[model samples]
Each structure stands twice: as structure tokens, then as C-alpha cells.
Target: PVPVFKSELTGLTLPANAEIIAEGFIDPNELMDEGPFGEYTGYYSGNKGKDYPKPILRVERILHRNNPTMWSTTVGKPINDIHMIQSLNRTATLWHDLETMRVPGIEGVYIPAEACGRFWAVVSVRQKYPGHSNQVGNAVIASTTGHYGVKGVIVVDHDIAADDWDRVWWALSTRFDPKRSAQIIDRGRSTPLDPGLPIEAREITSRIILDACTPFEWTNKPNEIFMNREVLQKVSDRWNDYGFDGASPVANMIDRLVKPEAIKTKKK
Candidate 1:
């Protein structure tokens, strides 16, 4: 369904979906089910087949060019184009929010595409303070989208790429201890589209925070042992000379799996 834009004060309604807009606040009490419309969670949320209240967007005024395109995004599964946009947004917003909280040694953040831009986040930060990984995980749980479908939040050291699940998993395998490094919060509030929620209320769900960062208490040895960056870079620069391709080994593996011929052979 299309949304009709109208001015409450002037009673001026747009000819159609006009491009220009003005913003104003409205009473929450005045809200109706604005949607069972398509939501980013790949579901028709709100009162469609079920009784639910949707948030209302009250228009205060109207202004626009002769012809303007309305910015709209499709909501569906992970591969949908809009999911890509949301992924970028989640990464930026979560990164900024954690940085603002003064969590030290944050190198990068990535919200995986498979999580539909909301369900999971992977953070790469330098391990400094003991229990710092848990602190970062809790902060993420309190963030906007992070409070939603986020079933898991994995924290890794700066050496691992936040976007790479394999590396993240490796970090978890080597660094995380199930007893001391993982936390589960029951009855947490998550987005309504989360399939894990047994009730319709947005305030009820559960989540796990995994501290994949290396244990700081292991002071008997160095936390990380790796080639120096300058040396690594020099090796990387001449990698081709050593008969190795510069392309990612992971990407090459994915290519083999997704190749059309491979699919046909598997089907046969």
C-alpha cells in the first residue's frame, strides 16, 4: 500500500508521493497500524494477518519539486539489495557508538550480510584490559540494531578481520572458553521479527555474548605472536614471486563452490 502525505495544520495533501518533506513530532496515542508492510526482517510485520500496533509517521507539512523520486527500499531476504545498504549502516552506526563509549583498541567492525544486516556483529579490537571483550559485547547489545535480531556477538583481536567468519571462528576456537568467556542474557528485548522470540512483544528475547578475545590473565606468555607488519607487508608484496596468487584464498574457494559447472556436477 502507498502512504498518502498530508499536512495536518494546512490540510494540504500532496498530489502524489512528492519528493520534498518536512519533519515534526506526533502523539504516539494517535498511531494506527502503519504497516504489515514489508520489513527488513523479510516479514510482513504489524497488523496484517494478526492484530498489532504499528508506529505512525505524522506529516506536518508538504514541499517538493515538480518531479521527485521517493526513496524506498525493498525488504526481503539476505541477498536483497537493501540488505547491503543496511549492512553498511549497521557497521558504521555500531562502530561509532562503541567508539563513543571509549572502548579502547577498536580496529574495525563488521555486521555480516547473512544476518540480514541486523542479527549479528563481529568486532575486531586490540585486547588490552582484562574482561574488555565482554564490555564491548555488552555495549553492542545495548545499541540500536544490536538490540534486535542479534543472537550472537563475537569479539576478536585486531589481527583478525571482522568481516571474515573463518578468522572470527578461529579466534573463538583458540581464545574463547565456554565457561568464563561466554555470557547469555535471558528475557532480552529483541526485534519482533526475530524467529527466536516466543511472544509478540518486542521486549522479550534472549542473546549470547561471546568473548573471543584472548585471555588477558595468561600473562605467562605473550598474548599474540605473529610476523611484524612491515615484514608481513614485504612478504605480501612479493607473494606472486613465490608462485602464490594475490587473490584471497577464501574467495577462490567460494568461487569453486559457486561455479555453475560445480552445481551441475553436484546435482548429477
Candidate 2:
């Protein structure tokens, strides 16, 4: 658990280990025009024609630890620390939301930092009934973490890890039919920082959900091919005998396990 302290000025509890803390209040009626600063989208936010109106925080007092270290992050485009942070936080938040909503058979959830962390998500689900994959896809868009900013979702089978791009592409190629598995919704809450939408119409956005799992209701499902376990083990065990420079790739195939039912709720 994180240590906490009560602020003497605002009577609010805060993290005791923080490097710096400011006791402040924002007046509801007060507004100020803020910037066109560079955003995580790799483009400048706000407009030259219309300065964005934002509430200003009036600092009453500031507190800091001795020899405080100021932490900062760079946010721009994809694959940055900010994007990575956003992906991690969003993925965990989405998973938590799904667990709280009792959405079963979820194997994994991943929001790639390459998609700016807010636009696309991939989910792997174990389909237990007809239309189960579709239900999970829709649930992702409706979740608290996904209802805002997310534009696309890809749902795959349990055999595919959400973060494994190779398997994700393979599933899309072999199992998906655009006409049968794609869903397009026209209305969802949007973030103003989304450059895809017009500045004046940034409050609403469209979403697309692509289901890549095979239909659970089908009577004749395609058989999945797999290598013989005994043969694979033998080959891996004798890898060095073949004058290989490194260990067999099969030696590193420890499966990742995530139990949705065991997820704990985050404290406020």
C-alpha cells in the first residue's frame, strides 16, 4: 500500500512519497485560454483560430521532499515513454473494467503503444457460446477505459495472445471475414486531442470492432495444426548436438497466464 498524508490546507489525503505536491483549487466560473502545445498524437493540440478555454488552478501552498527529484516524461507520436505508460495503464484499466463487469473467458487485453495507446486495442477471448466473441468486442468499447478515445478493437481467439502481433495477423487472415465479423458504431465519446476528427466536431467519434475468432456456433470448424509434442521436445533437447549457436526457440515458450476472476479492484 502507498503511504499517505493529509494536506493541512485542503484537508485532502495525498501520497506521502510524492516528490512535490501543490494545494490548489479551481474556480468553476474562472476560465483561461491555454496553448497549442505538442501532444502525444505527434501533432499540436488546440487551434490558432480558437484558443481553448480551460480552468486555472490557483495554488495556495506547495510542499516538497528534501532534495526532491522532479520527474517528467516526453510525449510525442508513438513508441515513446508516454505512449508506453498510457498503453500499460489503459490495458490494466480495461482489464479491470471487464473483470468488474463479469465478462468471462477473457484471456488477455493489449493496447499497443504504436497506435498512440488510445486508438486501438486487441483482446484475446475464450469463446464459450455462439456470438461470445462479438459480445466481448462490444464490451471492450463500452468499458470505462475504452468508451473514450478508442477507435478500433480487434478480438481474437484464446490461442492468440493479445500482444502477439504475428498470431494476431495469422488469425485475421485465416479466421476473419469482414462482412461477417466487423462492427461499425457511429457514436462514442471522443477526446479533443484526436486529430482524426474536426476540431469543431471532436465530441463524437466512430468505432470499428473486428472479430478475428472462428465462429463458435459452426458445426464444421477448421482443424488447427500443431507440431508433435514429443518430437518438439526431442529436437529442442538435441539442439546443441546440431552445432546451433544458441538454445532452441521452443525452450523459451513458457505460456503467460492471466486469471480474470482473480483480478483485484484498484483502490481510489
Candidate 3:
């Protein structure tokens, strides 16, 4: 027979096992080696060999449906299904935070897959103020959702796609100056999965704010570049009819004039 206990939060008595004895009390000061359990980071570290204090989770009661099925997840590489879900969550949360800031020329937000969904974020915003990119970077780090796992937050001009690594690198190479474009934060609670931290101590992580915006020193730049969508649509409609097969004639002509080889290959 199973005994039941009433929960303070749920206000219900839950069926609990009496004989399958595991006993522990919540001690704010006490710490023990809790797990060598498999973690989402795809590494196992716990009370086995390492001398690290583990926070205790007190289990008050247990409930079971007759013959319940246990479900579990494994985390490792970037392409994992769990990582994809986290990436989507990060994108939505980051986008919402940026929109709340009302930054000018804001285009889109994306957290790339390679960054493990939480360690890094890229934001695309219009450069309105002298240090707009830096402002965005700081705001991203300060955001409640952003505060968790992010070690770097990069802000780029609207011209750069937040999701495209190549374009992001190009912007960094051309627009960023190490002295002017970088901001470093010395201390924050680090992600536990980050192997850089020593197993015995709480990890402190540094955040890098990369301002990938164009130089504000250029006064002749327009505040906004408007695209004539109607004209663009017309060009797209007539692209195949024009001598440019499966390509935009205007784009092809521009490429041909600037660098002829760029237009030689058809886009797959």
C-alpha cells in the first residue's frame, strides 16, 4: 500500500511509495555529490570522483500512473533536436526583448545554431545613434531572458543578416575596429555546461559585445535606404524574360560591371 501526502503548492495529496526508501531533507547549507548523471551537454560529471557540492532537490512525494513510461532527453551537438527547439525559443525571446527597446532600424533577430542556441545572439538593427550597436549589445545582455546562458551578444547594421554567418563575418571584418567596436563584461553567472569552468567553483563568464555597425563618422550616409517594392517586383517578374535566366537582370548587370565572375554561375 502507498501513502499519500498533501502538497502545499498543489493542495492535493499525492500517492507516494513507502517501501522504496530514499530520504533527504532540504538544507540550505548542506551540499552533496548529486549526479554523474548524463546531462544535455553530453558530458557526465557529478558526486562520483569530483569534489563538488550539489544542490539538493527534496522529493516530498511520488505519483504514478499504472505502469508509467519514463521519458528522457540527451543533449550534445548543435544539430540535435533539443538544440533546435532551444534555438527557436531563443530567437523568439530575443526578438521580443529587442522590440521592447524600440531600437531604430531594427530588422530581425537570430541566434545561430553553432552557438548552442544560448551562448550567443545576433541582432540586426539600423544604425541611428553613434553607438547604437553597443547600446543594442548591452540591452541584449541586460534582458532577463538574455541573462541566462549568453556569453556574447553581437549587434549589426540592418544590411547584415543576423542568421548568415558569412555576412556577419564580412561585417565584422570590414566595419569592426577592435578598439572601437568591442565591449567586455567581466562577470556573470556562467552556464554549467561550459567546460571552461573548474568543476569545484561557480563559473563566472565574460560577455563580448561586438558592434558590427558601419562607422558613424560618415555624415553623408542616408538615415534609411528605401527599396521600391513595386519596381523590385516588376524586375523579378521580368527577370526570366530578360537575357538573365533564373536571375535578376539589374543584379546581374551590377555584378557583371563590378565583378564579372560573380554572375557567371547560376544560383542553385
Which stretches of candidate 1 lie above 4 Å from their native place? Answer: 1-35, 46-50, 54-70, 199-202, 220-268
Assess every candidate by TM-score: 0.66, 0.79, 0.64
User: Where does candidate 1 clash, by residue pair?
Assistant: none
Best by TM-score: 2
Ranking by TM-score: 2, 1, 3
Question: For model 2, how does the per-residue alpha-carbon lDDT over 55-87 read when each residue is reduced to its tens digit?
Answer: 889999889999999888897879899999999
lDDT, residue 247, candidate 2: 78
Please give the CA lDDT of all the candidate structures: 0.73, 0.87, 0.71
Q: Compared with the true structure, what per-residue lDDT tens digits does model 1 show for residues 105-219?
A: 8888998777888788899888787777778888888876577667788888776779978878887888888998889988766666665454356657778888888776676
Query: Which model, 1 or 3, shows the larger lDDT?
Result: 1
Q: Rank the candidates by lDDT, best first.
A: 2, 1, 3
Question: lDDT winner among the candidates?
Answer: 2
The regions of model 2 sitting more than 4 angstroms off are: 1-18, 21-30, 48-51, 57-66, 240-243, 253-268
Candidate RMSDs in order: 10.6, 6.7, 8.5
The all-Cα superposition gives candidate 2 an RMSD in Å to the true structure of: 6.7
Worst 10 residues of 3 by lDDT: 252-261
User: Candidate 3: lDDT over CA atoms?
Assistant: 0.71
